[model samples]
Target: MKKILKQVTKYEKRISVLLMVLSLALIFNFCINSASAASGDIIYVNGSSGNDSWDGLSAAWTSGTNGPKLSIKNATGTVNSGGTVRIADGNYNGINNTKININKNMAIIGQSQTGTVINGTDSAWIFKIQPGATVTIENLTITNGNAYNGGAIYNAGNLTVSEGRFTDNHAYVAGSAIYNHGTLAVVYSSFLNNDADGGYGDPAYNFAAGAIYNDGNLTVTDSYFSENCAMYGHGAAIHNNGVLIVTGTDFIGNSVYGLGGAIYNDNALLMANSNFIANVAYAAGGAIYNIGTLAVTGSNFMGNVAYGAFYAPYISTAGGAIYNDYGGTYTVDSCQFAGNIPQDIYNNTEASSGYGSGVITGSSDVQGATVKAANKTMPLQKTGMPLIGFISAVLLVLGGSAVSKRR
Candidate 1:
């Protein structure tokens, strides 16, 4: 009986030790998961029937069923290191009928490019990224947004957009699609049919960018800008007051009344393997207006038009593809210009008012080519004449080319 009691006690002690070990293991696992969540965690957002108050636990999400986190805002918590919010396929107008503000380092990803749509109201923007934040948005469409600066997004932080579309947005001042006061990188994205019209205010207030206004670093790759308009402002597609880099992109049918139908660069620009087609500017540079350091290589410019103002019909209109001012420095290489109205290259500060020292040609490192700049006889065409010039203008306007008029 004494030996039996000793055996039972020993067995109970072993069982207690095993139970304690198991409890410690469970606690360690929970701690590990919680630590991961504090850093770069993944949260699910279901658009169908998810609740905002519940935590995004794995068991809470089922196939085609609601998740714990319903909206993007609910998914955005105090994850200081960084996190990802996996959004399901649906049209999200934003949480609580307001703009989605991102004040942390996070990434918001959609299930599919076309299936996820973030529609904005007429009062607020779709997304507003605060300063010192790093945010990545992918596989989404930001449409029907409206604001004073960025109709779709107001970014004062580092932003990266991939495989996204910004369309049908309107801004009262600048950046109908995006206002970047910080670093921005765009890949395989598109900005289409956006407007920066000044919204019935003084034209002076609306000064830049119909598609994007960059006061910081801007980089774009494999993107497209189409039919963006800036009324009484510069850069219908993009206004770059900071560093700008564009590669393998296309700017088409953008219109501006001030300068740069496609882009206005006042700082530094590096454009390579891009295309500018059917862009129109009322002042100068139908495709690009450069007043700073500019570099263009392996690009194509076609069907671009630079028309003089209707009131000042005799105004000096030049550079159907590119206009380089006195303060601008340009290097063009391996570019093709075809069917551009007026001229292919115009140097405003040139002694002869055509291509000159403002633009450099072939060098030891650079191999340059061009269609040619127009002579004095081309710029002398009058509207009163029913000659080739009048016929060209009529055909240009009729051929789906955007036209801008400046007083």
Candidate 2:
């Protein structure tokens, strides 16, 4: 009996050791999976005939290839909550409303702008973001999507775009290429050849903003806006109904029919170290039209034209570079308005006085271009970062528990 008991004890000890080894192996495997799910901080694409890498994720998406081709949807995107969604170098195709909505605490990074493309043309936006969700779209091309408001993108949360092309998208009414109602940050992006009919479009109420429309806070840094045509009226390149901050951005070769050849501001617009060149407005405001506060500092406004057959004091008027009417104020500081012919600043009617009466020059009382200088130096914010510590900590805790079991 004593010998039998000894044998049983020895076998029990061996089984315990085997269990510990198995537990340790599981812990190690889990750790490796947690870290290796996403390769790098970026989504890489090798070569492209202008196809987005997100297309690869769509192949694995549950939508079965026929639905909106999304790299990450609500289901799969929720996996590895902090993991990144990578895209290979390939052409991704979506008709309309084919967007990768970033609702999780993750990032959707890209390889290069020249190697990716998002081509969608339907009734919904190509990229749509919800609130509290941060997303960054870098080094890609987004075009040919359709929305009632935002053609290519509609952002309700914080969004940032860097080194990409936004071109040839068409919105039903407003914001042909992009419509922003939340915080927007743009860097080194190119807005080219988007079309939106701004409220006087054919068939009535067909309005569009060729390049962009912002109803929230917007900051453009070192970007270029060109070849956007608002055939109906207002904001050939941009229509801003909220706060617009432009720093070191180039607005050139844009056309608007009614007002603001390059831009139309119904609210606050601040331009610093920017350039508005070669823009044409058919009715009024060759380069810019403001119905609210328009501030310019250290910016260049050159070669803008207002092509109007008949002119009115406030209606069908023309200004070389700028025109403001009814409760709008224009402030200039260290800004060169030369080569912007036919009176740089034209104010038709003011809340208190007539045109040109509301403009307050840099008198001895005001020192310099405060508004312009501030916007010019406006810092670009970074967005679309996930809560990396939260999920990673949880994973670590699980792994540690498994390791302890082994011990």
Candidate 3:
């Protein structure tokens, strides 16, 4: 009987220890799961019939909040899980003066692409993402903004824009449509009729990049830049001072005054399956101006024009497709340059005058050691827009003498 009691006590002790261990394990598991959990809310905004006092919950414009400001403010305050702001199909005006500032990790999505619009009223930017923020915008249109740097959107953090249109914006300095000081990814988007045409009289004023200015990592896929203009600067389409990778993008009808009618690259740039067509530059590089490492693969350049101002200091056309200067190295693989005016591939690195254009490589036509053509053939794409800005300046300079003689 004593041995039986002792055995039963031992079994009870073991069971008690096991139960305590199981309880501890269950508590630890619960704590771990709670610590890793995520929670947030989805907010709504309606522009046409919303009011500022309404709660951002209803999908109908009559009951939802009018603008994006309050919803963004609430989302930034939320902890753990990030927030999402869904906007309805209507024209929206930015709140908090002239711009809608975002300082949190949030997603702004539109109900429809063609029906949802964000208008800046030609006074401010539509969206400004601050540092340490992550934002994603999709299926919307941003238009009619005016600013010094970014007219439509200014990003100082990580930003992703998908399936959107940025049009009819103007900037006085750089990036008429968008300015990025951080990581930016654009997919299936378009930048049209944006102008970076201010800062004329100041000697330091070089109005660069009618569409975008990137000082950080930039990735563009299946995007388009069309009918953009830069008045006294370079890169009517894009100005890149950092790493840029463009795949399946198009640059059409962009114009500039100094160089790079389509793009100006000062750092690492890689373009694959892209198109540059009908771009005009008053000085050089109707397609691209590369001051850094540039690689173009499976791209096409068609009908690009590189002309000089007849009455200005520079009076020659060079590099109707690409003006590679500043000891910049470029590799063009399986790329085609067709019907480019004046010449193709203006290499200024090996100039006889030490500052002018240089020898031809892989082509039959050598125009007096001034312009070179890289013999290549490929197809092209088309975008709707008439060439205006810098080409008009070139024609005015050339035709000015004839008009004066007639007068």
Q: Which numbered prediction scores highest in TM-score against the true structure?
A: 1
The deviation in Å at residue 11 for candidate 3 is 79
Give the per-residue lDDT digits (tens) of candidate 2, residues 276-358: 76677777787788777676666766566666533454343467678767666566555555444455666665445543313
> Residues 3-26, candidate 1, lDDT per residue (tens digit)?
888656645543453344345435
lDDT per residue (tens digit) for residues 43-95 in model 3 = 67655555446556555544234333333334334322356778778776656
* RMSD for each of the candidates: 21.9, 24.7, 19.1
What ranking of all candidate models by lDDT puts the best one first?
Answer: 1, 3, 2
What lDDT does model 3 reach? 0.69
Best of the two (2, 3) by lDDT: 3
User: What TM-score, computed on C-alpha atoms, does each candidate reach?
Assistant: 0.76, 0.68, 0.75
| Overall local distance difference test of candidate 2 | 0.61
Better of 1 and 3 by lDDT: 1
Q: By the TM-score metric, which is better: model 1 or model 3?
A: 1
Query: In candidate 1, where is summed lDDT lowest over 10 consecutive residues?
Result: 375-384
Cα-based lDDT for every prediction: 0.72, 0.61, 0.69
- Model 2, clash count? 13
| Higher-scoring candidate on TM-score, 2 or 3 | 3
